[model samples]
Each structure stands twice: as structure tokens, then as C-alpha cells.
Target chain A: MLVVNTEFVPGFEVTKVLGLVQGNTIRAKHVGRDIAAGLKNLVGGELKGYTELLTEARRQAIERMISQAEQLGADAVVNVRFTTSAVTAGAAELYAYGTAVTLAGGA
Target chain B: MDGDAATFNFLILLVPIVLIVLGAGVGGLTARTHLRSLERREAELTSIEVNNLKFVRDPGSAADTRMVLGQVVIATDYFKSLATALRNLVGGEMRAAEGLMNRARREALVRMLEDARSMNADEVWNVRFGFSNISQMRGKQGAMQVEVFAWGTAVRRGASA
Candidate 1:
């Protein structure tokens, strides 16, 4: 599948339009890391704990998006974008979405 | 000049230095943690690198491509942020975790895009991302995990065999 940030692929062409497709996920890490972070904050530099937190969260969200595309029988996605929001006091949410379509060769 | 006066003056200076070190350490740690978290999250999204291409035989229908993208991209980003925020608190030498995650996202996206291209798809249409967090949130046996996904339609342009 030819995927590009632009709506059109210079060398490739679109052939069909599939219905709307999307993916979403909700995640909450254990609070232990947070407390550790708070304490670590007192000493300051890099909070190693939160680094792990963000890494894990990003993985989960991306996984869900891929699964959704698979269900739609999409070979590729283009112009992918990411967004985030605060769901609760301690929890946050990440989401990804894009267009799904079929393509033809330039030749 | 008195001995007592000298001791008192020394103690006052010592107190400020100690407080400053403690304050600086804490501030630095907190900032690092927050920055690391953001980077780690970006890495996570990069880990999968979901790519979607949508296209049709008729160029006139190109408008629909944008329409679908409007929803798909927003949703994907939303879910990606959600996952990152959920894991925002995880700490301990986990700084720069985003570097790894970003790599993963890119790898995944490239692989999927290559697969689509091999299928002779000119583009992908109606592309969107989906996310799921199957990890348990409560209880001693619970685990935390986030999955990010990117999806789209592969199409042939101007009618193909």
C-alpha cells in the first residue's frame, strides 16, 4: 500500500473508497510510578520512571490502531496523525486516525 | 569577630547551600521525568509507525479521501495520546524510552506500507488508527499495556486488472 502524508500519491493513484475506519485505546498505569516520580522530583534531572510509563502507553495505543486497520482489510494508511487528552486526574488518552484506500501503479 | 558570632554566620550560609541543592535536585528530577515521559510516548507511537493509503479508480472521488482522513487521523492521534498519558507515571531509568517506541512505530508502518505497495495499490484510502489497552488496571494480578494501530484502504487507480 502506498501511504503518503498528502492526499494524493504522485506516482500512485487511488481506486476505491472504503467506509470510515478507526482505532482507540484507554490506559491507566499503576500509581506506584507516580509516587516514585513525585519523590524523585525533589532531587530532579530525569525521572526514569515516567519514561517507562510513556513508552508502554504509546505501544498499546499503536497496537490498537493497527488492529483496527487489519479488520478493515487495509494494506496501508497515510497521513497518520496523533492526539492526546486528559481523561482523569492521573490518566491520559492517545488516539490515531487516517484514511484507508486502494491504490494503483504509476506505470 | 567573636567565636560565637563566627559559628552562627557559618551555620546560616550552610543552611542555604543545603536547601539549594535539595531544591535543585528535586526540580531537575521532576523535569527530567516529565520530558522523558513525553519522549517515551513519542517513541511508542513511532514503534508501530502505522500507515494508511486510500485511493480510487476515479480521480473525481478524491474528495472522499480527505473526508475519511479527517476522522481517521484525529481518532488515531487521540488514542495514541491516551495510551501515552496512561503510562505517564511509569519511572526509573526509563528515560528516552520514546526512542525505542518511535523506532517500533516506524518499523511497523513501513512494513505495512510495503505490504500494501506490493499489492499494487496506488494509494490507501479511508485510513484510520485503532487503539486498545487490554492490560488490567486493578488488583495484584493486573498488568499495564497499550497497543497502537494504524489502518487504511489500498486501492488501484483508474481501474486495474
Candidate 2:
């Protein structure tokens, strides 16, 4: 899965454009990490706790995206991009999207 | 005379200076941490806006290939509300949540676009986004699930998207 903000993937030429593919997951790590961080602020340095929180969130979201691509029967996903949102106060949403393309021609 | 001078310095100078430095450090750290939290929240909001399914025309196809993306969120408003309420209590950043939603929506769109192409369409045109709330009620509590969906028509492009 090659993800990018741009509409087209740079290195490779897209030969076939498959239909839509997507994946998503809702998470609660933000609230927990924030609470932990609030306490850690008393004695501060690098925020290791929040870092872990974010890493885990990213993993889950990516997994969901792959699952969606599988469902759509895409050979590969190109021009992928990531986006995040706070749907509610504590919970967060992570999404990855791109074009599912079959590559044959070399760019 | 030396002993007296040392004692005087400790009593009059070192104590106040130490106290002031400690106070400043604590205040500064608190402010920095609070600012970070706020920024994280703002980022999350921005990601949500970014995640919105925006259809784009495929440049490669000579035929018009228009694609629209949407998603099945698979999370409930109630769950979001509760999570948010908890965050308010603990003072957590909401940006992660927003990012997640945006990601989901985009993925949905991507899949739809791929599906269109598989049909050997030159391009998808007049792509549109549509959503359905698939929340079901449990015995006591309402279920938590929302599907973010993106749909569009695939057509061979002779004209520009």
C-alpha cells in the first residue's frame, strides 16, 4: 500500500483503476493517554506514554484500511493518505485512503 | 568572620532564589503541557475535515473517470459522546479521534474508486457520497456502529472530469 497526499502516485504509472476501497476504526487511547500525561506533567520530560498511544492508534487504523482494500479485491492501493479527527471529546478516528490500482507500465 | 558570612548568605540569598526558580519551572512546564493538549485537539478537528470524501478525476484515463469516496464509520455517536465526556474529565487531546474518522472515510472512497476501475471504466463521473446509520438497539443499550460510505458512477471519459 503506497499512500500519499497527492492524487497520483509518483514512481509508478497506474494502469488500471479499481473501484473504491476503505478501512476505519474508532479508538479511546486519546483520553487515557491525556489523563496519564496530565499526571506526568508534574514531573516532566519526554512524553513516552502519549507516543505509545499514538503508535497503537496508527496501527489499528492501518489494519482497518487493509481490510477494506481486501474487501474491494484491490491488488494494490496507491496514492494513499492519512487523516485524523476527534469525533467526540476523548475518542479519536483514524483513516487511510488511496486509489486501488493495478500497475503494469513502469513510470 | 568567614563562618558568619557563609551563614548569612544561606539565610538571606540562597533560599529565596531557589524558591523563585522552582516556582518558575513548575509554571512554565504546566503552560507548555496545556498548550500541547489544546493543539492536539485542534489537529484532530482539522483531520476530520480533511477526511471528508472528496471525489477527484483520474488523470490517467482518456475517458472521464470520476470517483467519489464515502465510508461506514462503524462507531456510534453515543460511544463518541461517552469517550468525549471522559476526555473532558481527564483533559485528553481529541485529535486522534478526528484522524481516525477521516482515515475511515477516505478508505471507503478509495475502495469505491477501485471498484469502478475494475469494471474497466475509463473514469468515474458525478461521484457522490451517501451515508446510512446502521446503529442497532441491544437489549438494554444501543449498539455502536456507523458505516461511512462513498458511491459514484463509472463512465468512460471522452470529456474532462
On DockQ, the leading prediction is 1
Q: Write the per-residue lDDT of candidate 1 for residues A15-83, one digit (tens) a residue.
A: 765544455565565678656544443333333454455445655665666666667776555555566
lDDT of 1 at B138: 22
- DockQ score, prediction 2: 0.07
Model 1, residue B159: distance off in Å is 30
> Could you say which candidate leads in lDDT?
2
- Expressed as tens digits, the lDDT of each residue in B37-144 for candidate 2 is 545644543321122223334444334232334343333233343444466679969643454345445545555555655645544434444432322211122322
Poorest stretch of ten by lDDT in candidate 2 chain B = B134-143
Interface RMSD of candidate 1, in Å, is: 12.0
Candidate 2: which docking quality band?
A: incorrect
TM-score of chain A of each: 0.73, 0.71
TM-scores across all candidates?
0.42, 0.39
